[model samples]
Target: MKLTEARQQFISNWGAFGTHWGINRTMAQIHALLMISPDALSQDDIMAELNISRGNANMNIRELINWGLVERVIVAGERKEFFSAEKDIWKVVRQIVKERKKRELEPMLQLLDKLENTEGDKKDKHMKAFLDTVGSIKKLSKQADKTLDTMIKAEESWFVGNLLKLFK
Candidate 1:
């Protein structure tokens, strides 16, 4: 297949994959396009390539920036802002894990902390059950938080080695 067709397929797949990570299809598409581009792309370039409205492209670009997967670029003598994705695939995965932990797991852990503070008699069966469930979830969440933290800080080789060991 042609490079254009290949790029289009990648962007579409990436957009669909992004939804599972709690991001929108357009955002992922923007990232995918930027990732594959040899040069930084202006907002107009992104819109033209993706066939999206300026508003849609702009909003998702901003969101991708917030998530640390994309960065704004400055071009000499160019008034229009250009953007690029973090081209290192390892860094991209780590950034996504870090952002998701911050946006999802941290808040969940906080809520679990709040829920665990319920003011009720300890012996009450319902309260006991509630605490049990929350406690279990909290335990798992904390472990996941730690594991993700390790992943965010770990070198790619070490992480990959240990991961592979699990299946071997």
Candidate 2:
């Protein structure tokens, strides 16, 4: 593929993948652009390159900064902000995994606590069934939380094999 086409494809795929992962798509696209760019980009450059409004660019860039996936660069004599993507793929993956766990698991664990202690209506089969379902969900969610904890602690490649060993 031509260079421009490849860049566009990367941006599009990154944006879509970001949306699926609960991130703003435009932010991901901006990261994608930075990843493939030969040089760091100013905010105005990104806005023009991506055709995004200034506020949209700023917001998503801030989100990326929070996630540690992107960083600001300073060019001599330029007051506008410039950005770059983290070049280390594993670092990016780790940040994503850590962030996702924080977003998905903590609330789920809280819900599990609520579900486990709820008083079920033993007199009603329907209520019993509902509680049973909740129990199963709690169990599974707890297991997931444990798995994520292991993932967060283990050396990067060790996790997959260890998880597979525990799968039964």
lDDT top scorer:
1
lDDT of 2: 0.84
**TM-score, each model?**
0.98, 0.83
Cα displacement (Å) at residue 162, model 2 = 5.1
Per-residue lDDT over 122-166 for candidate 2, one digit per residue giving the tens place of the 0 to 100 score: 768987887788788888877887876776677756866776788
Please provide, for model 1 over 26-143, each residue's C-alpha lDDT reduced to its tens digit, 9 standing for 90 to 100. 9999999999999999999999999999999989999999999999999999999999998899999999999999999999999999999999999999999999999999999999
Q: After superposition, how far is residue 124 of candidate 2 from its true place, in Å?
A: 3.5
What C-alpha lDDT, on a 0 to 100 scale, does residue 74 get in candidate 1?
100
- Candidate 2 residue-wise lDDT at 108: 79
Q: Among these predicted structures, which one has the highest TM-score? A: 1
What overall lDDT goes with each candidate model?
0.97, 0.84
